[model samples]
Target: MTQTHPSPAADTGPGQWNPRLWGLLLVLAGNMLIDALEVSVAVVALPSIATDLSLPLTDVQWVMTGFAVGFGALLLFGARMVSLLGRRRVYLAALLGFAAASVLSAFAQEPGLLIATRLVKGFCAALTAPTGLAIISTAFPQGRARSRAVSVYTLFGAGGFTAGLLLSGWLTEHTWRLALAFPAPIVLLLFALGLRLIPNENSTTAGTPPTGHRSYDIAGALTFTLALLTLVYGITALPEHGLGHPLAAGPLAAAVLLLGLFTLIERTVSHPLVSLRPLRSGALVRSALGAACLNGSYLGMLFVLTYQMQTVAGWSPLKTALALVPAAAPPAIAALASGRLVARFGAPRLIAAGAACAFTGYLLQLRPSWPLDYPGRLLPTLLLVGAGFVLSFAALNMQATSQLPPAERGAGSGLYQTAVQLAAVVAVALVAALLAGAEHAAGPAAATSAGRPALTLVAVLGGLGLLTALTALARPTTPTPSVPRT
Candidate 1:
């Protein structure tokens, strides 16, 4: 909620550090890193968490799913939350809430309690993540300086997953609780700095909608939330009960109906939660699809690889985590350079090339040839995937928001992130389902056999994403709307 705008006198010259600007950037980037950490940290620790809590793997998967559900479900209204509460208030409150949830998770004795805490943390993230970016937009002067700041900020975000992987690998060695507890202190530190450096809202723009008047669409929010929750529930249950089973079919059917109703509500409402007008933009549609596919395939692929490394390859947690270091870390550098890369090759080209790289990586990783060839097979694939992520992720984000008017940028970002979170949930669930189905087909070799098909599906997703990016590239380009001066 800090509303600090950069002063004209602020020097953001390359190689010259402005103390105030750097401090502000640190605070913002640090918080962004925390959000990113929460995402990847728990993923690596899931096996440990399940063992400690006496839960099945299916149930442990919900710790990650819960976060995705909470994040995706509420993000549709994040802009509304900002408008109603004021940005600084929501940012600070969500930070506090996130810290509290982390603490609760650290102490949780029951699986249900731990999952609930993750949900709270994720909901808090929905509130904080967009606000952090908004703060950066306000705090930094537009043009090259802002671009540099954003690239740095995003680079930190990319690095966070790697940091989390390394940290969780070490922390989970003693107890998974330490990994859960790690963020609380970091959040508190950021909160204290935020209190001092975060600027107060200008009286003119404080506590008011942009166009003088706009109302929150409560009905639309409720319906959309329910629809997403139902959808996730159905998909998550698919592994337990086949798709045709009543438990799975019922929720899936209801989700479709609820989503239909939500769309109708959006169309009818005077001040809709989302502006349906933007939905018609084919560029935005394809960009969002590209993001979903990229995340879905990447995360699902990681899930299977993690299992293969641990259970089949007989590697320790530390060794497994270290093996993935190449995939997790190099993307930070790639993200920083992506802006220039996009300028030369264009976002669509980068996206297509990135997806192709990811697909190739998956193909290389296919089947692993019995005695697990780490150096010959896995290392090269990891590097390829890492390079692909660096290329695609930032470019897709730029493309998604490129066509939006300034006023709707926040909502556009929320929508794009919503696609990411929802896709992650879907990816995990589908992979779970594939693995389960493979068990019946493979019998004695279920553990090893299950991974091949799951990985093949991941490769298919990568190919589909590549095709979508190419389709977008083939279309005529629309001129991006200019941001009007304040």
Candidate 2:
């Protein structure tokens, strides 16, 4: 086994534009754009897609969830494909698949087909997403160079989400198809340029091809997928169904059973897709949970504010996204400065401060109204949330990814990305559940009265995120698998 330690600034060698790190940066930024497009572009288009397909809210939700499901499920296999095939082969394959999926999604005649294609695209994205980071991880050593690379990689990924908001609202107004297809051409261009930018190191088999490849655990995969699928679906359905209703109970129970079985199989499997031991590292586990918590607040806040700006306040999509400018831009600024701050203050102190600021920001947003003032209300919360997300995003990735050995990078990264997506899935559903519950209790206009509760939720989640940072503050010198423990 190749003992991989964090060497961010390794000799990336010649033949690959040794001096042209800019090219690699473009490739990475493009990768972020691809992923960001998946989420952000769809938000503004949701109302449109829902209308065109005549799909109910439940069914329409799947359009995005399908992609997330594919993305999360295939992450484990994605890295291995890179390990088995080669970096370039896997990446190009993923890009081509994503492109095809985009075109198909663009031209779909019905919702099911469109969603199916999106799912396929998500799978391709899963394969490609980590490869981009792995390429950087290998290209740069673990010192300042790697640190900068990690910072840039994460910063772009964070900023890309915000950029998606601007582009989504604008593009969907004209044609939703273009929103999907727009990036495909750009990705192809990057694919062509990326061929020379990075070395073709065969990551799959370091030496000779390893024989007797273990068969994938389809049972575990099915059960785990079904479990999460049912649980999330059930939660999302609760707004319509009463809590005691069997409609929610049946699927939720099935999810529990299936997920339980998944654990049992993973423990006994030859090559487990998810390793249980990583959760043993208290530091990593806490950090992973913290990442999830921060996102629960961040994503939920985004959804609420977006809706408030448009549906309640009667702002246009463009105007709604424009309202996000204050919140969106600061993360870019923070992204640039966070690396230095992390170096000086470390992840712990920064995480705490960020969380505190985020808490204060959300509290300020407790009573949002139609006017949606940017300077007084919007700007402060946006600044706080942006700062918190920037700090937490980089720190979480570093804590999760840095603790692993070289061989485990693929699986570890897969787990990390999966958790992030799962966080989004849960945030929307869970936060909405809470909001609806509170709204039901407080009459129709709950967002106005329950701003404090919503803000409180964000603050509490931020506090949990802070706790995760404190746990990881010591930076333990061991492999911490980035997945849930049994």
Candidate 3:
């Protein structure tokens, strides 16, 4: 069967460069970068924040996990909100909310107040991140233009992690408050430009249904929120309270029950928060698995490596950040170059290749040496890991969205982003568990011994992701014929 790809936006010829379209991409990509930047920027500033507020080490970490929990939990609900209120309206409002949260965070005198602000910012981010990608998918024509836009969008997102690390170090050196203050001005500026740039209508993705007047599904919203929040909280808490502890197992069990209830509600309700129909697509299922593995492996690798750099190698924050540049830079470059290649080789093969590279990177890092050599031992791992990101990240995002109709694009984006956040949470937990076990066994030199198990766990994750991507490739291929614009 030849699939006819129909784009929501008016198609300009391939040679024609539209300034307005590019402007929209810039605003959306910038928004994506800001959301991702928040996740990492605070990481380097946590110690400074802890000192200023006199918080315990364990409590201080909630400043980060709180944000991730809120961000991941509200995603599906946010997509439902976008369906009710327009995307343009939700996008701008979310940005405004983010700005306000940033200001509150800057002025917060207590840890409680600061954590509240972080949660608010995370919720707002949940609103904007998926909407930005949906906006791009709807604004660009289906083939080359959409592909390029996704590549650029993914590149900015990948780059933001590195940006946050560098910025946090500099800002925290001056004042940790500066790190908190930075996002307000940037978000407000983007909000202003977005009013002029983002498309006003609902046709932001391929199969988006017309938005007129529909009663909001409040039941669906509540069930979905409770389910996701419980799941995220359970996984994040696992590191603090061992997996056998009630704190870890209780919430996870409740999360499972709530999710089951949510599924039942969705099936029975006339209006659902998430339709399970689109999930039947093999491509989307595999892409979601690929996304899970990609984030899980990459983040887990970073978790163990950070310990290796700081605890074992005695590297300063500045030195660690600089050393990570090789691991971060290649993805951005690869993302830009990958649009054409994605079109030629297709997303599945590239995804498999990327996962394979990441697995190989982890394999190379499994050496249990006492004093790790950076150039001889670590540099090649970083390079391969970066190369793996370059290949898989954009392709995963693109493949997930490529087949969805506009109406379903919001759901698709929400699902993809949720996979990413949940994977990161799970990955960190898994690595933490492995590290804990290693430490218990190794006693005095636990730091040196922990790296091997952590890296091995990451390698296993990468291999699973590679297997998922290969399955996507095994699906029957059909010609994707472009539908001409009116």
| Per-prediction CA RMSD (Å) | 3.8, 6.1, 6.0
lDDT tens per residue, model 1, 8-104: 2255454344676677788889988988888778767877786678765456777777888778877767668787767777888888999999999
> What TM-score fits each model?
0.89, 0.82, 0.82
Task: Count clashing residue pairs per candidate.
Answer: 2, 12, 8
lDDT of 1 at 194: 78
**Candidate 1 clashing pairs, residues 3+ apart or interchain:** 1-87, 1-88
Off by over 4 Å in 2: 1-25, 54-59, 138-155, 192-199, 202-212, 368-371, 401-413, 432-460, 467-486
The TM-score, computed over Cα atoms with residue i paired to residue i, of candidate 2 is 0.82
RMSD of 2: 6.1
**Candidate 1 weakest ten by summed lDDT:** 477-486
Ranking by lDDT: 1, 3, 2
Q: What's model 1's lDDT at 336? A: 65
Q: Give the lDDT of residue 229 in candidate 1.
A: 67
Clash count, predicted structure 2:
12
lDDT of 3 by residue, 1-486 (tens): 933322234456663437767778888999899998897776667656766888633455556666765687677777778877878789999999999999998999987788788878888988988788878867887677777787778779878888887887677768889988898998899988887777765344444535664756778767766776567557656656767899979989999999898888888877776666668666677788898898878777766766667545666556666777788778766656666666677777788899888888888887766687789768888888888888887678778766777787657767777878777766666565566556556752666676787788899998999889887778875322222222
Whole-model Cα lDDT of every candidate shown, in order: 0.77, 0.66, 0.75
